[model samples]
Target: MFQKILIANRGEIALRVLRACKELGIQTVVVHSTADADAMHVRLADESVCIGPPPSRDSYLNIHQIVAACEITGADAVHPGYGFLSENAKFADILAAHNITFIGPSGDHIRVMGDKIEAKRTAKRLGIPVVPGSDGAVTEEKEARRIAAEIGYPVIIKASAGGGGRGMKVAHTETDLEIALQTARSEAGAAFGDDAVYIEKYLEKPRHIEVQVFGDGFGGGVHFGERDCSLQRRHQKVWEEANSPALNAEERSRIGGICAKAIADLGYSGAGTIEFLYENGEFYFIEMNTRLQVEHPVTEAITGIDLVHEQIRVASGGGLSVRQEDIKFNGHAIECRINAEDPRTFTPSPGTITHFHTPGGLGIRVDSGVYSGYKIPPYYDSLIGKLIVHGRNRVECMMRLRRALDEFVVDGIKTTLPLFRDLVGNADIANGDYDIHWLEKYLAKGE
Candidate 1:
């Protein structure tokens, strides 16, 4: 049993996990950099420790510092919330060596799935359809060009170890393949310290679909349904919804079953999201996030499950509390990631939140890590809050979301509130008739 858990990351997600721990009667120790001293998670945690300076590498990503924090704080477990070292297998191993539970899956599962090329191969072996791409990392321009030709012109060069849309570039012609590969490799090396690059057929106008699957590490898995994350910008999701409008019940069951079976077969445990790109009625595997997603609130909204609580309990060897048959899908839900930025230009806006008032009422949830007087440091992600709403149907959910967004107010710093205010009024968004490219095109046209 975990006595005290040390949260190894900052931002809203740290607050998110802390809330779950509080409900479970578990103590928490929040580790933060100097810049996040005023973060909500730090304030609410049972104990707080400053690991290092403001930079992520010096603090959040520093394994030794994190372990030291846990050791000194008497935390029995470490919850690496979403980003930073959440999927880092080495970090998991480090925690294991320290005899501190890592509140996620096994280190091996993380290592295997964190490698994109190897993960794709694993997916294919398990009968999960992967995007047509290089069988492995392409090291030569000739090989990349040949793969591009075989895949028929439009191809994407991706860093095998990359994420967050970095280390990815598209080439529509053979002449552009070499540059795309080189740029991807360079960026990959700089970002992930691994220059391994791969080629994949560029899918145009596909919906970003993901299934939330939880495993018991004992040959059983359950799915909490799917989320449509098609509305994205530069690979980061902007808006998310549960029980995708593009998918009917039959389609949902088919894909959901495939994902559940795959996780069970792998003996995977804890919360994970299997992402895919859907086009023309077919789902192609993209990647799997071994930890809870930033958009997990939507899934929780529909499933009525506290995923963070589940993750902590599973790590503490409590096993699954609910089975697949016991799972029930509730009404629709949507989440809008409200960021501290210019609504139109997307420039970061960091400063004091002069005034703050979260929307309230039935069917609305806002996960925020900042308060009115809190000074949002410029050294981190701009996401200040997650505005989620649940309803009997998608229509009601959207209506509630719009009303909540209207009622929401954060003064002093610019926010993407205006962007979302306009987004909720778009017809395509209302009808769920947009693709991955739709948002960019819509933004480009200044809609």
Candidate 2:
């Protein structure tokens, strides 16, 4: 195990990794932007370093500054909590060149899996079912139109190197494809520095399910289970639940096996997620996340596993501690991403938090970094914390989540607490009868 590790992110994820390090007897050096000089992670870490200015390019996303911070702190490895440089293959390569391990997959694996188009190809080659559409990059508008024609109308143009729903456009007809193709290509180039986009048959009302898998950087891996993240808005996940009610044992096993095989085929290591879009009783590989997800706590809650610790152990050249047969899903777990924003407008509300309180009790887990008197920054993600709860079943889990959300309080800034309160009470969510677009429709109704 690493004696000391540098966390290359901030906010709740940084705090989450710090707690895991503390439990593993590993000292942590947390890197913070100048804007985050007084951040909770900075205060809690055994060592803290300011990388650069507030803008992500000058700070959190600055690879050299992060590597230098690790070198200075004598951190044996670097754990990128989630976003920013977490999925950057170049950052992983830099750490490897510095002889410091990155507590995730190898640079090669990330580079392969990071590209949505390439990942789909790899999955197809490995016999994993993928959404039918363009087999490769669509460089020309004609090729995109041709692919769309073959896949039928209502095809989706996706960035080769995209995630979080950016660089995507839907076209239902030939006329729509021409404009959607051009716009998607331009947006893809701007967002991911890749002009290449591909086509996929868009499934209406699909359930967003993902498999959480652990690997050893060799040919062996194990899957914990799946999470249903269908509760989303603008293609970003707002809520997640483990052991999706939408999936049965047979479906779970099939998807889990495919995910494990795909990861193992790529020699993936540490923790990662294989995302899929489920529709019409079939699962289609969407893409893979090469880092711990923001909603990982829900998986941990149901599995009784410490994913961060497992990440460190895997990075230290240790194989998975548990086999596939040993893994079992104990119960249902739900996670609500508590963002510092308005419930109605979805606009950020960053300011000094005059009062902060979190719910605690049986099966309630609050992963947070800020506290009372802390000022929420306007330059970063709107996320303030994560409220995760576990129970014997889905019904119990929902009840617990509602109770916990009710107890959570943050003053001096508007939050999504009320939105979550409404969501848990929504009939669609209560009956698990909603898809990815449910949240948007719910918000439209202003319920």
Candidate 3:
């Protein structure tokens, strides 16, 4: 076990990792920007270091400063709690070269899975189902049109190195393909510094399902099941549920087994998510996240597994803590990502939190790094917290989630709490009859 672990991020995830380390009796060091001097994670850490100013490029993303922090604190491992440098293959390699451990997959695995084009090829090669599309990036307009023609109309152009909805454009017909390709490539070059784009058959009315898998880096791995992240806005997940309401026990088992086998075959390590678009009883691979997801709490609630604890254990060479047969799914769980934004307008709301209150009882958990009187800086993400609820079944889970949403409160800033309240009461959300496009359509209705 590592004696000390440095957390290389901020906000709720940083706090989440700190709690796990504390539970395992390991000391923690948290690096923060000047803007986060009063951040909750920094306040609660065993030791804290101010890396740089408010800008992410100068602070959180600065590799050299992070390495210096590790050396100064004598920290042996780094747990990048999502975002920032979590998926940076170069960062992982640098840490390894410095004799410090990155508590995730190897740099090579990160490199392969980080690129959408290569990830699709790897997924298909691993016997995982994939969307029918181009074999690789299509740089010329002629090739893009050819692939779209072969795949039929309504194709989507996506950046080879894109995420969070950027560098993506959909074309409903051949006429729209040229403009869509140009727009996607322009956006890709601007956002990721890579002009490479690929085409994929776009699926309508598909539910976004992602399977969570963990590995010990020694050819052993297990799947914890799936999360239905179909409720999204602008490609960002707003709500997530475990043991997808859209899937049955058999379907869940089949998909989970396939993902587990893939991870084991690659000899991967730590936590990863294999995302797919499920439509017409078929699962088409999208991409893989090489780190812990923001919606992981829902999975933990259903499986009774502490993923962070397992991540630390596996990274430290202790191997997986349990066998595949030892894992069991227990209940239904849901997570609502509460961001500091206008519920109706979806504009960022950054200000001091004057009053704060969280819900409690059986089956309710709030993961946040904010408190009353804390001034939320506009320099970072608008997400302030996550509310996760668990129950014996889907019905009970929704009931509990509704009650919890009503009980959560934050003042002095606009928040999406009201949106969740409205969503939980809607017939579609209540019945779990929603897809990736459902939320946008619901918002368009202004009901």
Candidate 4:
């Protein structure tokens, strides 16, 4: 086991990793920007280092400074808690070259799965189902039009290296294809420095289902079930639930087994998520996240697994602790991503938190790195916390979630708590009858 681990991110995730390390009796070193001098993670860490200023490029994303911090602290491993450098293949390679461990998959695996185009190809090769569309990048107008016609109208153009809904456009007919291609290409180039784009058949309404898998870098792997992240706004998931209300026990087992076998065959290590678009009882591969997801708590809540501890163990050459049959899904779990934003206007709300109160009770958990009197820095993501609830079933879970949202409070700044309160009371959300586009349509109707 590593004696010390350096966390290379901030906010709630940083604090999440710190607690995991402490539980395993490992010392922790947290790196923070000047803007996070008073952050909760820094305060609770065994040691803290100020890397740079507020800007992410100068601080969190600065590879050299992070490496220096590791060297100075004598940290042997780095647990990049999502975002920033978590999926950077180059960063993982650099750490390996310096004799430091990266508590995730190898750089090679990250490189293959990071690119959407290559990930699709790999998924298909691994016997996983995929959407029917272009074979590869559609470089020319003629090719884009051809693929759209072959796949039928209503195709989505996506950046080969895009995420978070950027560099994506949908064309309902042939007339819209040209402009959609141009816009997607331009956005892709600007956002990812890569003009490459691909075409895929767009489903009118599909639930976002993702299977969580873990590997031991050997030939062993297991899956922790699926999360229904269908609720979204501008492609960002607002709410997530485990054991997707859409799938039955048979469907869950089938998809989970496929993902587990794929990870085992590929010799992947640590935590990874295989995301898919599900509609009409069919699942189509979308992309793979090479690191822990922002919505991991819901999965943990259902499976009772300490994913961070497993990551540390597997990275230290210990094989998987649990077998496939040893894993059992227990209950329904939901997670609400509480962001510092206007619930109605959807604008960023960054200011001091004057009064803070979190809900408490059985089956309710709040993971946050903020407190009263703490200032929310605008330079980073506006997400201040995640409220996860677990119950014996979906109905009980929703009831618990509603009660918890009502008790959650934050003052001196706007938050999306009201939005969740309204959503919980809606008929569609109550019945678990929602898709990826449901949230956007709900907001458009001002319901």
Candidate 5:
């Protein structure tokens, strides 16, 4: 086991890693920006260091400062809790050069899978189904047009190196394709510095589903299960549920096995997620998240597995102690990302939290970095907390989620609580009949 792990991030995820280290009897050293001196993780860590100022580039994303912090703290391993530099291959390699474990996948895997085009090719070669489109990057407009024609109309142009819905443009016809292709290339260039784009068949209402997998570099691991993350806004997941209501036992086993095998075959270690787009009972590989996901709580709720603990173990040159067959995913678990944003306009709300109250009951978990009097810094994401609930089934989960949400109180600032409150009572969401596009359309309709 690692003697200590340095957490190079902030907010709830940093706190999440800190708690995991505590249970494992591993000391935690948290590096934070000046804006996060009052962060819960910083307060709870065994040792703390101020990396830089409020801006991410000077702080959480600064490599030299983070490595220097690790050296100063004498931390043997690093646990990058999503976002920031979690998927940066160069960061992993730098840690390796310093003889410090990254607590994630190999640098090679991170580099290859970080690129969407490379990831899709890897998935397809591994026998996973991918959306029909260009075989590789479509550098020319004529090439993109040809590929679109072959795949049929209504194709999506995506950045070869992109996530979070940036550098993506959907075109319904040939005329639209020309304009979308040019604009998408420009956006991709400006955002990723690699104007490389690929064409893919766009399913109008595909459900975003992802499978959580943990692995040892020794080609051993287990697939915890799948998460239904279709409830999203602007490609950011808001509500996520485990043991998707859309899949049966057979379907779950099939997808889970495929994801696990792929992870193991790639010699990947630690925790990661294989994301997919599902439509018409078919699953298309979208991309893979090389680090822990925001919705990981839902999976932990159902499986009772401490994923961060697994990452620490696997990264410490240990294999998975739990077998795949031993994982018993019980009940349905749901997580709502409580962000500090306007409920109506979805604008960021960064201000002092006058009062903070969390609801507690059976199967309710609240992971938050903020408390009363914590002023939310606007230099980063607006996610303030996560509210998770588990129940015997989806219906019961819904009920528990509603009750939990009702009880959740964050005063003196706006939040997306109202959106969730209304969503719980909606017939479509209640019945689990929503697709990826459902929530956006529903919200736009002012329902």
Candidate 6:
């Protein structure tokens, strides 16, 4: 086990990592921007260092400042909690050069899987099914048109190096393809510094399902299970549930084997997620997330596994202590991403939280960073907290989540709680009969 580690991100995830360190008897140092100087994670950590200004580029995303903080704090490792530099391969390489363990996969694994095009090819070669489309990146409009004809109409163009719904365009016909291709290429170049874009068959209503896997660089890996992230807005997940009611035992085993083999082929280590798009009873590999996901708590709730501790143990040169056969998932767990935004307009509402109250009881977990009097910052993501609930089954889980969301209150700033409450109690979500476009249709009734 590491003697000490530095948390390189902020908000609830930073506090999440801090609690993990505490349980492992590891000392923790938290790095924060000036805006989060007095945040809860900073107060809970053994030591706190101000990295830079409020802007993420100079603070949370600044690799050098974070490494320097680790040096000053005498920490032996660094844990990036899900965002900013967590998936950056160069950051991992720098940590390696400094002899500091990056509590995730190796630099090579990240670099290989970080690029969407490369990951697709890798999955294809490993016999994992991928959505049929372009052979590789299309450098010109002519080539893109040719590929679109071969793959049929209604395809999606995406940045070879993109995530978070950026650098993506859907083309319903040949005319739309020309404009979408040019615009997508330009946007991809500006955002990722890579003009590379690839085409894939666009499923109109695919369910987002991902498997959580853990590996020890030593040829041993196991999947905790899958999370149904079908409840989304604009390609970003809002609510996630474990042991997807949509997947049967046979499907679960099939997907689990596929994920384990894909990463195991790359000699992957540490914690990661293999994301897939499921539609019409068929599954296709979409991409792989190289860091811990925001919805990981749902998996933990069902499996009773401490993923952070697994990462720490794996980093200390240990293999998976438990085998795949020993793992068992019980009950259904759901997580709602509570964001600082208006439910009606979906616009950010950053301000001081005047009155704050959260629910507490059986099977309710609240992972939050803000409290009474804390001001929400506008420069970063609008996420304020994560509300998780567990129950004996899907119906009970839905009921518990609805009850929990009703009790969650943030007085000053508007939150997405109302939207989540409406979602959880809806007949579709309650019965698990929703697709990716479900939320959009529910909102479209208003528009």
Candidate 2: tens digits of C-alpha lDDT, residues 1-447: 789999999998998899999998999999988899999889999999998999999999999998899889899899998999899899999899999999998888898898888889888988778999988888887788788888898999999988777889999899999899899999989998898889999888899999999888767888999999999988888999999989999999988998888778767788989888998899998998889999999999988988888898889988778888888888899999989989899999999999999998899999999999999989999999989999999999999988898899899999999999988998888899988888898889887
Residue-level lDDT of model 5, residues 270-344, one tens digit each, is 888999999888999999889999989998899898888888888898888789988998999999989999987
Report lDDT (Cα) of residue 10, candidate 2. Answer: 94
**TM-score, every prediction:** 0.98, 0.98, 0.99, 0.99, 0.99, 0.98
Q: Can you rank all candidates by lDDT, best first?
A: 3, 4, 1, 5, 6, 2
* Model 2 weakest 10-residue run by lDDT: 259-268
How many residue pairs in model 1 have overlapping backbones? 0
RMSD for each of the candidates: 1.1, 1.1, 0.6, 0.6, 0.8, 1.1
Model 1 spans with C-alpha error above 4 angstroms: none
lDDT of 6: 0.90
Candidate 6: tens digits of C-alpha lDDT, residues 144-205: 88888898889999999987778899999999998998899888889989879999999988
Q: Which stretches of candidate 6 lie over 4 Å from their true place?
A: none
Error of 5 at 218 (Å): 0.5
| Tens-place lDDT digits, model 3, residues 134-169 | 999998988988899899979999999999999999
lDDT (Cα, 0-100) at 171 in candidate 4? 99
Taking the candidates one at a time, how many backbone clashes does each contain? 0, 0, 0, 0, 0, 0
In angstroms, how far off is 253's CA in candidate 5? 0.7
Clashing residue pairs found in predicted model 6: none
Per-residue CA lDDT of model 1 for 6-125, tens digit only, reads: 998898999998998889999999999999888889889999999999888899999999999988988999999888999999999989999999999999999889999999999998
lDDT (Cα atoms) of all candidates against the true structure: 0.92, 0.90, 0.96, 0.95, 0.91, 0.90
